[model samples]
Target chain A: MPKAELLDPQGQAVQSAMGRLGFSGVVSVRQGKRFEIEVEGQITEERRIELEHLAETLLANPVIENHTLTIE
Target chain B: MPKAELLDPQGQAVQSAMGRLGFSGVVSVRQGKRFEIEVEGQITEERRIELEHLAETLLANPVIENHTLTIE
Candidate 1:
């Protein structure tokens, strides 16, 4: 089996924080969880990227969330 | 910093496991990592996706590796 890191959603995701209009405000801490995926094929480089795109666009919440794919 | 799962490299990552060549040979477990990012801008929807793409293409390894972007 190949390896993958699924970016699942977390509770109370902090999207942004207020700044003094001086700091420009930063996304202090965007948090998320991960899962495992068992797929088919050679796990080629191109397929990996394609899979990642699928994760971000479909598996994950595009509105306020995103996922990082990890292969081992 | 903005929450970002950096798909960093791990040692001896198991990409696939052999079955009787039967398990159809699956990608059993793809592993990856997460990190924090502090960027400039509103962290808008488009921006978030853009950031994720950057992570996948540049920050992450395209071959035998991919990263899932998570925004909290």
Candidate 2:
């Protein structure tokens, strides 16, 4: 999830636009990015670990973002 | 979520970069945006419906993306 208030500019802009479009009461909003990866085989324990490492090191910038992995 | 292969270029580039960085077996990757909104009050049934409509019409572009709302 994105750090609260960090996405303020973009989130606030979107909120304002939504309000103008008749969507009010949205106290706040935070926006971030999501990634879905299709691996070659079953997502085993080792693969999960590797994906987590990759997510932290490559997909997300630890300084301002966080990531999660889910199988579906 | 972003349309599957639609995120190909960016995703593939990330995957390739990861491989070079010693992380392999990631057959494919799809990247998308995530939005976390903090509403003003309790998310009742009516609020949920309104949020859904807002997400479909404003937060996400139906033509090429999908979204989900969760309370946390």
Off by over 4 Å in 2: A5-7, B5-7
Worst-scoring 10-residue span by lDDT in model 2 chain A: A1-10
lDDT digits (tens) for residues B2-70 of candidate 2: 666365577778878878988667777777778877778788899888888988988888888878778
TM-scores of the candidates are 0.31, 0.83
lDDT of 1 by residue, B1-72 (tens): 112243423211332222332233344433444446666666788777666665665445666555667665
Each predicted complex: what DockQ? 0.19, 0.75
lDDT of each residue in A1-72, candidate 2, tens digit only: 666535557777888987898867888777778887777878889878888888898888888877777887
Clashes found in each candidate (C-alpha, N, C closer than 3 A): 24, 1
Predicted candidate 1 versus true structure: per-residue lDDT over A1-72, tens digit per residue: 111243323211322222321233444433443446667756888768766765665445766555567776
Alpha carbon lDDT at A58, candidate 2: 88
